[model samples]
Target: MDDVAKGQNLDDFLINLADGLSRAQSRLNRYPVMNAVGQQSMVYHIPRLEFELKLQMTAAETPASSGSGGRLPLQKKSRVQFLPVKASQHQSSSSATSIIKGVFVATPLDATVSQVRLSLSVEKKAARKAQVNVAVIAAPGRSVQGATVELNIDRELSERLNKTPLKPSTRLEQASLILNQESVASAGLIIANQEPEGQIIALIADLFGQTQTLLYRFEQG
Candidate 1:
């Protein structure tokens, strides 16, 4: 049963039990034939019942709003971080695998991120020709599952990244990467096995223009 229903039922039970105990006590007091020992035992039991009743009443009266006690204020910014994955190992291979397996992204429980974009580079050169794939997976805490969003890069920008060299100081705006807020909030990027050895940069931006970046490097194991 739901919490509210359970609480109501408990309240009714306690009330009935209390009324029955009171009636029994009154009957014992009115009957002079009852031995003093029985009366004393009844008195002791009364206090214990009262204590239990008080406990239950207190619990029932407690506010249900306490469920949100652990939640922080919505205005607070949450820190975002990348979950680490074990480096891939290959035997009889001359080069370390650049493919990153199982990439997981995380945000604060109340994060307000609206957009997410990824930048990739190898040997300081833009890896625009490389395709980055991602799959959305469960995040920590009570976040909803199966929410997947896809990011779409425009052809002009894709062509630019493929042709032009990427500068270390390049801003995300300069790259003209367009990110859908809904998709970024629910999805993560996946780099397949064919990706080049480089640094994968994740740029997450909130609605307020505040941005956070997580960088992952793929090297030969």
Candidate 2:
């Protein structure tokens, strides 16, 4: 689900749960969030709003105009930087390994773009497994509904990662961090054995380029 839709879903969960707040203290413990400072307290109403939005989105058979001129898959312009990959021990060509990481960033989706997808990777020696962390930083004026962000690993890459072995002490990748509206963008790393370093970097570049191309087309339109 897109960030908006997931948020909406979470909102509904909270509201429904809140309805039974008669035993306030009992349920209160269930959600330590309500005890938070200021804005955190407002987390209580999320569930209700999410439920309502879900109903509305579902009832609307036709795509409700987003009230914007963005393309079918709306996306925004954003930049991704791959910080260095520090591995414990570099492997030779004979080894098949893979390393992956998440590069998080915060920026707006071009008025023309609606969806955003990213990929990050590093060289590998032996066949290894890889994973990526994904998130959506909502756009200011746009709405994302049931937005599905998929992590695609081609058959060839998938097979390679599954068979690679891991390097015990190497920090193939770093952990990913999730950021919100007021927070800075960040990412996590999932390094493995199998995928080549050159191949991994190229894949990441390709993912960014593809997103850029989509945004470009939308802007040009």
Candidate whose TM-score is highest: 2
lDDT of candidate model 1 versus the reference:
0.32
Count clashing residue pairs in model 1: 4
- Residue lDDT tens for model 1, 1-221: 34333434544644566677766654343222324432112222233343222221111222334346658543432222212224362222222222222212223335544233222222322333222333222233323223332233222322333433223432322232323432223222333345445533333222222222223343434
Give the lowest summed-lDDT range of ten residues in model 2. Answer: 212-221
Q: Where does the lowest 10-residue lDDT sum fall in candidate 1?
A: 51-60
Q: Compute each candidate's TM-score over C-alphas.
A: 0.18, 0.20
lDDT of 2 by residue, 7-108 (tens): 445345445544544244323322323223211132122222111111222211223444467555544422222122245545344333333322223244
Residue 159's C-alpha lDDT in candidate 2?
A: 34
Name the regions of candidate 2 deviating beyond 4 angstroms: 1-127, 153-201, 204-221
Assess candidate 2 and give its TM-score to the true structure: 0.20
Local error of candidate 2 at residue 128 (angstroms): 2.4
